[model samples]
Target chain A: MELRINGLKKYYRTGKEKEVKAVDGVSLEIGKGELVSVNGPSGCGKTTLLLISGGLMNPDHGEVFLGEKNLYRISPDVRDRERVTKVGFVFQQFYLVPYINILENVLIPTIGLNSYSASVEQRARDLIDHFNLSDRIDHKPGELSTGERQRVALARALINRPSVLFADEPTGNLDDYNAEVVLKYISEFAADGGAVLLVTHDKRISRQAHRSVRMKDGRFVGDDTNPVK
Target chain B: MSLINKPGKRISIWMIIKNELVYKKFGFITGVLSLVIATSGFVGAMILLRGDTLATEQLFMEKERELRAEMLQLEDDYRIIMRNMGYNVLILNETQSISELEKEGYASTYLDYEDVWKIAESGMTTLNHLLPVLQEKIYWPEKGMEILLSGIRGQVPVYSKPAHLTDDDQYRSPIMERVPEGKADLGSEVAVPLNLRPGDIFTIRGEEFEVNRVYSRRGTRDDLSVWIPLDKAQSILNRPGKINGILALECVCSTEELGQVAREVKEVLPHAQVFEFSSLIAARADVRQRAAKLHEEILQAEMAHQMELRREKERLASVLIILLITGASVWIFVLILNNVRERKHEIGILRAIGFSRLKVLQIFLGKSALMGVVAGIIGCMTGALAGVLWSGTGLSFSGQGSLVTPPVIITGLILAPLLALTAGLLPSVLAANQDPADIIGER
Candidate 1:
């Protein structure tokens, strides 16, 4: 699978009179099984780029293509439908519903999906076991550590086994040890032929990606093809 | 997951119900209260009205019976008075030529005296003779009179002595034996027997007659007067053929039809003064008017009472309806608002999970509707129990012990919940349509 964003522009209104460009005429492409990181300082539109790429936001002037389908060409409803089955998202805040248990959290995406089956429990069990969360499957997010919670979120993001994964500051809230563990899972996901668009401020996690890009003031600043030595 | 998915996609009613139960229990309680209020008010009014209706019917029936009885008595009295008046006219005409000496002379002399006696008694006898015919003529039966006289010698009974002074010399008059003291005080021309002590006498037509008996009047007309035989009356009047008026008292027919019967009698006997029993009683008009006024007043009062009861019932029902609707709406609104606040995150999460804005709204609203339906059923049962308890006090006019037995109460119960559901809709929809992205982004 390949993902492409062309001539993406996003603007924000401040007060009633002021307008600021959050993303300005930026474009990029990622191939199948590639792990790419979009690195930027705070408020640099890294997360915005990821959100737009995942079809969560409408760009003022842009087009995003996943495989051969124009993501923005279809209606928002159709785009949401496609995104549910074809793309996965992980947020910096974990976005794990505090009330639900880990297994229930993982099973959220399959709730109303036509292809969902009773065997989803077994699939969820498998994912929980793989993430070393079997003992904590019944525990709520409040009961889980930061690493456990992030793992559960990641498990939920990959529950439908989407072809492309977008992670926005996935390690932004984790300690060093849990951050390393999270990066390892993301790398494993990329190696297994899933495309990843990762946004992060942490250089240590960005170094693990095959391609790294830097952004500043709503513009791409650098692209490093070489992995960090 | 597949079974759950199928139902979830189609809008899960059970999920909606569960969510409402979890969130809006207080609204449910208020909805039940509303049903109770409405049902109690409506049914209570009906019960009171029914009781008043029954009482009114009873009073009307009683008044009708009394009026009917009074009219019948009046007719009976009218017939009696008319017959008596006719007899008096005949006696007066027959006795006009009789002198006192001749009347006494005729009594002494041995003669049949039948023609004179017949003439003297003709008026009364004529009525007696015509009674059977009149009985058939009128709708009611006529009354007949019988009279008899006997003389006593000392304590032994004897015939009156003729002035011939033959074998019956010891015979005494019946009047002397029966007359008590004070017969002389009535005057000397009143014939007291020579062998007896003097007593009071009463004059009839300027001639005195001894009083024999003093008793209260026993007929429908309570009159006080001297009773004298036909011959004596003729002698006192000095017209040997004349007698006092013959009275015919009647005891049949209802008073209600008396006026019509009296009118009919007047048409038949125009010369006689014909009057019913009610006409003789001076207080009759006053009594009747008073009774009529009382009846009218009672009817008016009862009508006013019923109107008041109806107005009160309506007022109560109106108040109850207003309170029920207001209370239910307020309660439902508050409950839904609180529920929305509590479930804001759930709504946000569902929206994020690809549940459409419409779907989320349906879920919330459906839950509230389900709760309303359940509360309505409970309210009906509660109202029914309350009606039973209240009816035991005899306060209810419906005469029904059960709330559900009254159609109005049942209707109220049904409508109250429907109102609650309507009240809950707007808040639920607003809560559901709130933007999930904004909510999620808040944290």
Candidate 2:
């Protein structure tokens, strides 16, 4: 499904009768098999855009269309269903469940769902194996290195087979090698027909994307495609 | 290809809770111990209070029972006395008026007591005490000790054999209806100083009475004394039913009742004296009154002692309750507050990575609940053991284990977890509802 956004806006109250527009009238589109990167400085609404698109925060005014359905037009419960089954997110800090093995951390999206069976277990094992963590499947997050934890978090984000993936500074805490490895997975996920949106201050991350958008002061400043880094 | 199961999620939640509890040993121990100690105090106080209450109640009941039995025994004794005295014995004292008798709990009884007569002196005979026949002599000293015998009359019947009768002598003839009519059914072996037969007569004080029947010898006082017909004694002694004094078997009654009777008798017979025939009855009543008064004082002391115990229990309970709430609440509140503060970034990451706010709340609540379970078990056991150890049993040293009963333990088990949950609530909710963008900065 192609993800479409139109006229997105959000605001915050700094004091009585005083307000700041965090995200104001922003718009973008990403097709299946397309990975889009949004780059901006601090308070430039890059994170706010991603949050609204991922249904993590409600926008004051916006229409987000995932395929033929308008995400914001639906009930919050239905939005949650969409958020869980159709969207996956990655954060800069690997939010690994501190007590659990890597495989169990990857299975968090299935919470509150009664649809558990043998195949789900095997699928978790397979995903952990795919991440080159088969030997460390039972190792708690505390015992893992930074790179391993990021790998576990990536595996967790993709465990539910979301149609769109949102990443907010996914490699912000990583060294160059680990960062490249994380970007490569995002690129590979786009190549596998899942739409991708990556918000970051790091220009290096946005430089190599199929499309790049630049934002400033709650508005998009530049939109470029097919450009050489 | 990837899939996840619900149980897999539950296991994940369980691991998160277990992880913090095991890794952060100091926090877990501090939290648990706070709850345990407070719970133990509450449970222990309640156990002791309950035990004391039961023991005091039991003692009070026993004392009451003993008092009731004593009162009933007095009542039974009074009933028996009434039974023995024929329930209707009468006495006459001519000196008193009817209005005076009415002042007691009885009316003035107009009935008169029949007399048993005595003679002052007689010549020509020494009466044999063993002689069963009553003797009355009617003669004048100027007439040379001669007796004029009255003709035979109808016999008056009585049931009590004279106490003076010897074991071998039984009354074969009907005795007089009046009390202590000195005559008896004399035993045959009795000796008489006078020559007398069943038809013989005797006189005294210028009046005469006949010996209706001569009886067998009675080796007792009956053999030595003489008895005369009641009417003959009245005329010869110059006294009738208005005799100066008479002995009676009274209605066996309570001291209060007997006092009332004596007052009534005094009202009717102002110069007459009435009292317990045996000295022991009055003395026993006095003893009982003193004993009852002493028992009452003892009971009042016990009541005061019981009141003190109750006040102490209330005081201890209030203190324990405050201690319990403060300790448990402070422990959970500070522990969770610190934990949530430390884990803000983790919470942000979870929200960004697809875990819900509810899931975050569950993780922390589960940690506190685990603490509650341990506190419950430890608190209950310690409290129960303390209760048992404190109370001593029958001889005042070891109890029948009236210490921590079921309610105390139940309250501990139920209340411990609840306190922990309440303590953890605000911090946990704050942590759970934390925004991912705020702490982890756009995660």
Candidate 3:
């Protein structure tokens, strides 16, 4: 699937008198196997752009399309349905439910919505194993290392096998070694024909992207195609 | 964070509840306990608030007042009946007027008292469910001695009293005020000397009468004295209701109450001789005073008890209300709300991964409903058990004798879950309304 944005504009009220354009007429597209990165300083609206593209927020104007389907034109709930089956989010903070074990955390989205059989469990086990955290699969997030926690978050994000992966500053809290492992995994995901839209302030991350969009104050400043890629 | 790998999951309500129990044991247990307490309170209140079942003291006062009113009516009716029969009458204040009455040749006497015995014709039934042993106790007082009781015990010679006094006096001392309707005083006394007591019953010529008391043991003409009810004796002796002798009291107005009784008696016997026994009238007044005081005490006691019961009932009701409203519902709302706030980021991730708002609502509401259901069931069982265990006094549930009935059960079960579901409402909606974008962006 392709995540396509056209003139997407989302405004925010910073104060009673001030309205800030968080995503001001921004547009972009990330096709399957595309590893696109949005880079900016603080307040540049990269996160806002990522959110609107992922169907997590509504744009004041313009539209977001997943392939031929205009997500913003669809009903909010329908868009949510589209998101549940089609998109995944990896946050910098690794937002895992604290009480649930890693395996159950991975299963949280399926709760009361889907049935988990041996294959489902096996898929989750494979993800944990691929992340080199099989021994910690049943452990809670509190008991895991920072890298392990982020990996669990990654595995959880991919548990639905979303066609589009949204990673917002995913490696912002990770060390260089852990960040390298995360980048390699995200690169591998794009190699496997899954689209990845990564938002980061880190130049190292932007350099690794096959394509990069640089933003200043919610508008695109430049687009770069990495020479190596 | 996803429902991707397989066909849509069919998660049952039970599975959700099981997960809730596993995840939130303390909240679930507390919710249930509060519901149980509330339900039990309701069960108890139902019985306590029922009509037709008065507290024992209240019942006693009611019955005593009824019996007194009946006795007064019966006495008035009997005197009127006697006067209409063209019988000469003499009214006396004191019953012990043998000296004055004998001097006037109007003293009624009996010798060798003969007991008139009659068998029950057939099918004489009593309303008492505890009456199967009545016959054994009725005819042969010794066989059912424990149940043998005396309504009236008037001696024929030494202490003869008209027998109509028995019914109202059944539960009182036999010396209370009596009836004036009777047959002529028999000159011959047919005595039955046996080990029989005054309360004993005997039969003669298919007639039945309870022994009043052993007549004089002295070897005198009074030794044969025996007494029976005036109407029964008249019926047995083949005489109409008539009194051959009169005992009269010329009452002087010492109190307004005596003036009333004197006025009533004078209304029946216009020309009857009257004599005053001031001491006996005073004694009767004293007795009436004591009785009135006792009745007042009983009323006050019952009123006080009722107030206490009312207060207690209100307390239980208030507690139940609290448990239903603020206790179970509010506490659950707060707990689940805290969970939502604490899990804001987690909720955001779930939402981003495709969990719908409705799904989010379902999780929290489902947990609350489970809590309610469990609390309801446990409360119902324990409340019913409390009813059964305390049914000895009916104070546990429904102060009345009603058990934990069907309405109570239905209310307990339905109300608990409903209330719990209600408690979960805002929290669930708030949790479902969480904005994934805001939460994720904040992270």
Interface RMSD after interface superposition, model 2: 5.0
Q: Pick the candidate with the highest DockQ.
A: 3
Per-residue lDDT tens digits for candidate 1, residues B39-71, read: 444445444444444445555566667756765
Against the true structure, candidate 2 has what lDDT?
0.67
List, residue by residue over A1-229, the lDDT tens digit for candidate 1.
Answer: 4799999998888789888777888999988889999998988888778767887677899899987888889986677667778787777777775645677778776743544555776787788899899999878788999889999989887888888899878898999999998889988988898899998889887789888999997889999875542
TM-score of every model versus the real structure: 0.63, 0.71, 0.62
User: Runs in model 1 with CA error above 4 Å?
Assistant: A66-68, A114-116, A226-229, B1-293, B309-324, B338-345, B383-392, B395-400, B405-420
Question: Where is model 3 chain B poorest over a 10-residue stretch in terms of lDDT?
Answer: B127-136
Q: Please estimate how well model 3 matches the true structure, expressed as its whole-model Cα lDDT.
A: 0.63
DockQ of the two-chain complex in candidate 3: 0.30
For candidate 3, give fnat to 2 decimals.
0.58
True contacts kept of 2: 0.31
Candidate 2 regions with alpha-carbon error over 4 angstroms = A13-21, A112-115, A227-229, B1-15, B58-253, B259-287, B393-399
Candidate 2 per-residue C-alpha lDDT over B235-348 given as tens digits, one digit per residue, 9 for 90 to 100? 554445423323333433335545554555555445444433334445445666777788789888988988897998789788877977797889789999999998887777
- For candidate 3, the docking band is acceptable
Interface RMSD of 1: 5.2
Q: What ordering of candidates by DockQ runs from best to worst?
A: 3, 2, 1
Better of 1 and 3 by DockQ: 3
